[model samples]
Target: MTVWILVTAALGAALSWLSCRFLVLPLLRRRGVMDRPSERSSHEVPVVRGGGLAVLSGFLPAAVLGMLGYGLASGEYGLRSLVTFDAPGFSVLAMGIAFGFIGLVDDLDSLSASTRLLAQVGVGIIFAAGVMLLLGVGFFAGAVIAVSVVYVVNAVNFMDGLNTLITGWTLVCALWFTLLGALTGSGSIAIAAVALALAAAAFLPFNTNPAQAFLGDVGSYAIGGATVALAWMSWAFGMPVVAVLAPFVVPAYDVLRTLIVRMYLGENIFQAHKSHLYQRMHQAGLSHETVARIHAGAALVCILASVPAVLTQGWAGELVAVSIWLLVLVFYSYGPRFVKEHRAKEHGSSSNNAGGRA
Candidate 1:
């Protein structure tokens, strides 16, 4: 079963890569629908934006096969086992696609903030209501899923300003989730994580610093959806520590911190800007590659550390892992000041900006 799941996920990731290299990427390039830099952009040249369509290739098929398998094996339509079509999970996927489409429209042409907000709300309702119905999770959970999903998706989109930041983090999360699934004996979790991780790895060749391609809005929302869905399912089945931190610690921390800082300055939380801790690192003189490496390194470290935490099957390792990651979050937020400042060294900041993200 493990071998089969891994093979299936590998196929999905490989297919997604091909879609990017051949269909999705070429279509974007030919249409000249590329990401161009401005004050909001961290990159220099016009690169393809809908690169995340590649993720859909991996995610969508995995959802179908996995869900069908679960339904057959468990004798229940456990769609949550696959793509999480159940309420909260369904809503998460829906909202992610919604926000992603908004980003996609923004990529094609400017969209009003209201329009984007509406779509996000629509998706949020689905996710929130689903959790309420199925898991009986609560007002706090509803709010958390709704707000966290939007912010994380947006933050992920924000992080996409660089080369592989989104992809790199996503890759790390996926690998960690896969191992967590393996240790805990959850096939769907392992399948989903490995598939997405492989997809990230496949794209890393094109997305590394001085990246040839950008994931755009499509990719950001997609990654956000997958991250939330995986976390939800992992927790629903058991109290695994990896399931908890995978969504909240790495991605959620940055979003919450950024929102607080922006609100403190009386800025609209929804507006786009380049002031994220990672962005600040870029502004303060760290190259996109260096900043990306540091964060990706953190993610990799989390993966390594999480192994024992999951294998241990208790809260002890998880608690330690969470503390370490939380401490790193503090550093991620406030650490740049200690580094020697370098001024915005990259002129065409866009290209070099494309480092590790998601």
Candidate 2:
């Protein structure tokens, strides 16, 4: 069974890579679905966006098949296993795909912020209502979870100013969630995570610094929707909320900080701005790769923090995890200041070198 899952994951990654390299990129480039550089952009040149569709190409079929396979072997779905349309995994995948389509439309037509928010709200409510019906969650709790889903999706889209940041961050979270699923014996989640993780890995080479392509809104929407859906389901089923949220600490903190700062300054929160912590670091002369690695490392710390909390199931373990999160939040909040200092030092050294040569 494990071998089958592994094979499915490998196949998904391979297909995703091939699709992006040969199919999606070409089609997008030909159609001029490219992202142009602007004051808000990190890149100086345009690159093909909407490359995230490759993820669905690679993940959707593999995930559906894996779910079916698991259902058959475990007799979890009886004969209906072959047609998994009613399964939770299928529901999540379908919703993600739908959101990705909406993202693609935005990529082409550029939806207004209010319009996008309305769409997100509608989707969130429907998703939450579905969860209440299917998972037996109560109305109030489900509504809260729905709001979280909206936040996660937009948070991902907002923080996606740098090459490889969103893909890398999502990859880390997916892998962590995969591990958690395996530990909890939740086969559906484990399989879904495998598909997501590998798909992101396949997309990374093209998305890294000096990127050949970007995920655009399409990819971020899909990734964000799928991630929150899976985590919400896992939490509702049995997993602790802490374990589910641990991997997202960095992005969550960044989003919250961005919102608060914007509100305090009387700036509209929906406006496009490169004021994110990672963006500040990039503008301060940090390379895209450097910022990505830093964020990935921070994500790793959060993942590690989750392990003890999951293992101990005690207040002490949870407290320690929370403490680490708070500490990291403080560091991230002051990250811009450090970047400015580093940039100043670099500029000074360069000036001294030029003067010495003169």
Candidate 3:
């Protein structure tokens, strides 16, 4: 079964690659749509940036295949709740599409931040409503779902600077979910996890920094929506919040910490600036590609650290979460030193404060 799953992923990845090469990129380029590099951006050259459209080529078919396989195996007319398309599941898919469409338009026309945020709120409301429509669920669940959807959308977008930061973190989260599913023999969960894992893997090549393509709005928005949806479903299945959190704790904390600091410093948190710790590294003369790989590697370590939490139950999982979380706090405190050193070198003859505003 594992072998078959791997093979399926490989095929999906290959097809996805081709779709990016022939379909999405050509269309985007031919239409003269591309993100031009500027003084504020990292890339020195103009590269086609919306290649995230390729992810759908991988995500949709794999998810459908997972659904079909599960349904056939179960001999049921209704879709399997695990990986198949059902009411809430289809609603999740619709919200992703809506988010991606808004992002695609933003990439094309450079929409204002407020404009994008409004669209995001619309998508979030749809997602929250779907989750709230449970058999006996109530207003508390609806409130949680609404707040969570909005937070996930913005938080995930915050981590998307540099090359494959968001992509790498997403892959780590998906792989953790898949492993947990396999360990517990939850076929539906495993199927959903594997589908996401394959989609993220397929996106890796293009997303690596000096990224041949940026996730732009489409990639981050859709992936973030799907991730939050996954978390909501997982929590609904009686999993603890820690299990829902273990996969995202690092990226989530980074965003939250950054936001707190930015607010304290009187910065417009909504403004696009290279103040992110990772963005600082890129400004400190590190190549975009190097920064991407470093984030990816860090996410990989986080995934490894999550194994025990993913496999453990109850307080055991909480223990692992607490331990890894403290480590992230340390990283946040000292992580800027690496960037500061490089900044100091570039401006040896002048006084510059790159720590707060790179």
Considering every candidate listed, which one attains the maximal TM-score? 2
Q: What lDDT is obtained when candidate 3 is compared to the true structure?
A: 0.67
Residue runs of model 2 more than 4 Å from their true location after superposition: 78-86, 346-358
| Pairwise lDDT winner, candidates 1 and 3 | 1
- Provide TM-scores for the models: 0.81, 0.93, 0.84
What's the candidate order when arranged by decreasing TM-score?
A: 2, 3, 1
lDDT by residue (128-236, candidate 1, tens digit) is: 6776676888888888777766666666766677787888788777776666665556665666667677777777777876777788777887787677666666666
Tell me model 2's lDDT, rounded to 2 decimals: 0.82
Question: Over the stretch 1-358, how does candidate 2's per-residue lDDT look in tens digits?
Answer: 4654686588779878999999999999999999999878998988998999898788887777787788778866544633544555666686678678879889999998788888888888988888888777688987897799889998888878888888898888888777776777767777777888888889999998789999999999988889888787667666776788887789988988878998999998766788888898888878888888888888888778777778887778788888888887788777778989978998999999999999
Ten residues in sequence with the least summed lDDT for candidate 3: 82-91
Backbone-clash count (model 2): 0
The count of backbone overlaps in candidate 1 is 21
| Candidate 1 off by > 4 Å | 66-102, 241-243, 266-272, 302-319, 341-358
What local distance difference test score does each model get?
0.68, 0.82, 0.67
Superior by TM-score: candidate 1 or candidate 2 = 2
Q: Total clashing residue pairs per candidate?
A: 21, 0, 0
Which has the greatest lDDT?
A: 2
